[model samples]
Target: MKRSAQPLVAAAVLAVGVAGVFAILAMRPTPEERPQVKRAPLVEVMSVEPGPYEFVVRAHGTVVPRREGDLVPQVSGSVQWVSPALASGGFFGEGEPLLRIDPADAEVAVESARASVARAQSEAQRARRELSRQRTLAQRSVASQTNLDDALNAERVAAASLREAEARRVQAERDLSRTEIKAPYAGRVRSADIDVGEFVARGTSVAKIYAVDFAEVRLPIPDSDLGFLDLPLGGGPGGGEADGPRVLLRAQFGGEEQMWEGRVVRTEGEIDPRSRMVHVVAEVEDPYGRQLASAGSGSSTPLAAGLFVEADIYGRRVERASELPRIAVRDDATVFVVNEDNVVRERPIEILRTQSDRVIVGGGLRAGERVAVGLSEVVVDGMTVRPLAVDPQSRAPMDANQ
Candidate 1:
């Protein structure tokens, strides 16, 4: 009886356990049948603000002088005096004496010329008096015709001699003036060779110098960049003065970076055959003038010669255009514009120009429209997106929490 009772209890426990498991399964909630929901991608967007935008083209070049030449002496002589400002890297004023050759020979030549002129004048006067007296005598039948002819010839010869002496005198004066070499313009000396007591020949290059009134920079830009610049195609003033497009030059100077203002002065006469680059000349007036000092909170710096600088040239102004990040535009010249409902669709845009970092759009988009940025090629039309507003300059999300 005990063995039968044990089997019966075991069977009862197994049945109870199975019933409990079934009861718990019945109490569980049933799986609900529903349609799948597509997940929308998160995208960064920028608001298009179409307005007048002056394009900026970047280029780099070395600063140079608008006018540079070798300082040569027109008259040969021993250098009796040398200007301190005639040395290499020296500054000088316009018409300032750079060197003084020994003027002893020049002075002697002038004296000799003056003496010749005086003698010629005396002879000419005496011959004129003699010719007049001979004319009177011939009219009175007192002098022979041969004698009157001789007097006339003497007067003419004296007059010619006087003219010759006067020419010599003028030449002597010119040679004297050239003995002292003066600066053609206010400039800095690039190099010098002669010194005091050194004999220099005529037309010898004693030094090399350049004008500092206007510093020039030859900026080489691609031929494609020509359309954006209002350069002087005729090599005239179209690229200069206040009317020309402005330029901002940046460079490291005095152990710190500095900025300078200039303008496009002109373009080179011909394109570079090998590079197809068109070099544009930029001019800055009074680079070393007083305007550089205390001009703008100790920030106005002079554009020195030979300084390697980066140029940001202001180009053509577009009446209505928007600058978008380069990644925003697709290869097909289309952009993804996100609507108010967060639906993105491909829209064609008229691209004016493409730069390394951005694209200048001329048309095909309205102001205040959100343009998707940094989207992948896998983007499809009518795709849903979670839009995030971003800064125009930095492209960072405007919301701090983002």
Candidate 2:
């Protein structure tokens, strides 16, 4: 009787546990359904305006002199005197004497040549007088034909001697003049390696100098960029037309940023073998302060030699082209534009020119179109976007934050 009652009690306990589990499950509430929502991407956009645009090509190179020459001595002599401006880094005017070699020897040489010339001239005069006498004597039959011939020969010899003497005298005078070293042009001395009493030989370098009126820089341009610049590749100044396109050079000097104005003067004869790039020469006038006084402009910083600089060559203008920010242009020559329905679509563009900060498109874009300049995420065609317009004057974008 006790065993039978134990089995019935276990069965009753299992039924009560199952009923409690069902009651807890029924008391819990179900989650409510929510509607699907899509949010549009926010982007900064600029209006596309087709008009005439001046393309500028960028390049870099080192500053060099338009004209540089070695100061070579023409006469061999000991340095007798040195000008104060003959030192390194000294400034000089054109035709100013920089130094003087010992003129004592040169003066002596010139005097000796002059004496020889005088002697030759006197001999020539004596010969002429003798020839005249011979002619008269021959006419009277007192002098033979042989005597006339001898007189003619003597006169010819004397004249030759005079001519040789005159040539020597001229050379001697030139040497004497060469004893003084004069500046060939207005420039600053790059280097000086001589002093008073120092012996120098002819054809030896005395100094090095460069013109201060203008400076030159050889800018390397890629072959693809040649079409944009109207460079004088063959040579000359546009057949007497206006000067080449204007250029602006930038470089750091004296711990501050500086800019120098220049123009495209010419291009190198051949392409660079290694880079396959065409080298263009740009010239900056009044690199120093010398020309400022004449132009009625204040003195400004000069573009010194060997300063590495960046150049911008302003090229031909094109009409009916769309110019947009560089960020708006995709790597595949495509741009994201906001259509009338505020949807971003990828459109193919005919790229006319590309620059560091901007891109010019020749086709597939028109005026009154809005181009998305910057996007926060990957974009697809027909994707809805919230565009923030940019002001042309301030170049700032107007958005919710603004």
Candidate 3:
């Protein structure tokens, strides 16, 4: 009994010691300290500077010739000669002979007509002489009135015959001239259907050609973008060709990038039924001219037909417009602008235009104010933020690491 009582007293003492230690630890005073406030989140920002900005409308289209036609023959005969430049991809000038038909038949017909005309002229002269003689005889009372009438009738018939011969001679000359097939304009041959010694009929297509004087591209502009462009749509009041907006076309040619300058000539009269888009025609003059080929650096190439290209239409220049990164504008047309105290305040902004990389603000921003760009955290109105200011000129981030 005594040993059991001693073990219980020892266990009770250990328990009391452990409880006392915990109680002392809980009662002990710690060093006095103050609570800390959370630091503001760091955000990169850019200054809002409203200034002159040139609006550019981007579009794409296929290049095509301004004038395309099929070369047809006006006169038919066996081909006597074919110009070397009458093949596919050959270039020729206006009125240049592309082919010559055998002039044997036409030449013979012309000679026959000429001889008949000569014979008719001689007969008409003889008849006139006879008529004069008959009139003199009548005045001298040597010829009867019936004889005078017969002489007049013979003179009239001879004059009609002479006119008929002259008409036939002129027609023969015209047919002879048409034996030489000529190019109607300065252009490049797209194809050829005939060769030397090959017979062709009149009004048959010989080749396909397109004028190289100018080219056109039909660009589809969205209805929303129409406000940004001053196109001559439906001949509406958008200004004349002399003061039309300029367009720059870019494309890959000969394994290199090439650029061509053009102008907005006109727009489609109505919206396309399928796309509901307005197509504007841009004209590039002298597409094949050496001056145009050398417009850019490096060896330049011509803007050939059927080439796909991108176009940049120069639009109106907006003055004092605020330009901001796309991320700065929210869905509700509001931006997080950093106030003077470095606190983010949500402010409404008028979006004049939206581009691929930036947004043009028409109002609600000052020249020197800072707007938060690319904030990683969820933004709240009137949230205090540490703005890492960005230089307007260099576009470098300031206090970025904070």
Candidate 4:
């Protein structure tokens, strides 16, 4: 009976162990039943059409006076009055009085000189009458030849004295005119150094005037660019109308954009020793007179002397060069062009020029070809790309903050 009971217990234990193993096996996962992760979508991109574009070179430069002149007092005198327009940045016309020095002393000198001239004229007339009388007396033998000679010498001396007095008078008048300062050109007075009651010595600066009728822009180009310049016919860099090269200049001052059309008038004739750059001068008409006028009190925008500016000199434009967005060209001078099958091919390109947002490709690109713009790291040569149709207005990428 004990043997039979042991067999039944063993069979029951074996049956329970087998059932537990089956249950564990049923809950275990198979290779085909594992979880899979979904991938994020590729970044959307736009395409650019290649075409002929203009080439431009950008450089920085300074705005300077077309012609600047210093107003200096020719005669010394105390300042008696100044023009209401004599302040710094004041505008005036040609021959306009800028300031007035005390001319009282100059006037007194003029009067004194006139009186001397009158006295000299009386003496000269008397000498001439005596010489005539001596000549008549000598002819009649009433006067000796020596007496006639003495009378003639006296007349000549008197005539010399009269001429000297007249010259002194003219000089005195000129000095008086100098006391009244006048504008040398039609321009704005940059500065007035003298004031009412201020004593200015001779040759002292009374004011500074600049002509805005035409303004000058001095551009320093590398000596290599000399070939492109149309040098003046007879005069080297700075002379002759032939030296002037037609150029377009756009200027901005105080948030207002101004367009100036001008020509390269001349060159500085020599390259700078340190910079190896040749100074090219271009002339533009100050039509509105804004650049030559002072702020608020003038008709045009005030272009102050010595203001720095950005200049764009239009070089030769290649008619057949391929132009694309700057982003389409990589740093290695390679561009990724999309084939008809929508496959990207890396093509080597020769960059002719680069403008602000565009680049001109002189080689390795054909017209009407689509180029990838703003590509991601995943995009490479021969990689498949699905370009989304980009809206012209809404193509800009959304910022992360948005």
Instruction: Evaluate all candidate structures by whole-model CA lDDT and list the values in order.
Output: 0.88, 0.87, 0.87, 0.73
Q: How does candidate 2 fare on TM-score?
A: 0.85
lDDT of 1: 0.88
Model 2 per-residue lDDT tens digits across residues 1-402: 998899899999999999999999999999899998777788778888888888888899999888888999999999999888877778788899998999899999999999999999999999999999999999999999999999999999999999999999999999999999898888888888889989999999988888887899999999889898888877756763247878899999989999999888888899988898998888988788777865788788889888999999999888789878787889999998898888888999999888777788999987898888878887788988888888643558765421
* lDDT (Cα) of model 4: 0.73
The pairs that clash in candidate 4 are 231-243, 232-242, 232-243, 237-267, 290-300, 290-301, 291-303
For all candidates, what are the clash counts?
0, 0, 0, 7
Query: Which candidate's TM-score is highest?
Result: 1
> Candidate 1 clash total?
0
Model 1, runs deviating above 4 Å: 1-37, 238-240, 290-300, 400-402
Residue-level lDDT for 290 in candidate 1: 36
Runs in model 4 deviating more than 4 A are 1-54, 126-148, 222-263, 287-300, 325-337, 342-351, 354-358, 371-402
Comparison by TM-score, 2 against 4, better one: 2
Estimate TM-scores for all models. Answer: 0.85, 0.85, 0.82, 0.68
Query: How far off is residue 274 in model 3, in Å?
Result: 2.9
lDDT of 3 by residue, 372-398 (tens): 886767768888887787764455776
Model 2 segments more than 4 A misplaced: 1-34, 40-44, 240-242, 293-297, 325-334, 344-346, 355-358, 374-384, 390-397, 400-402
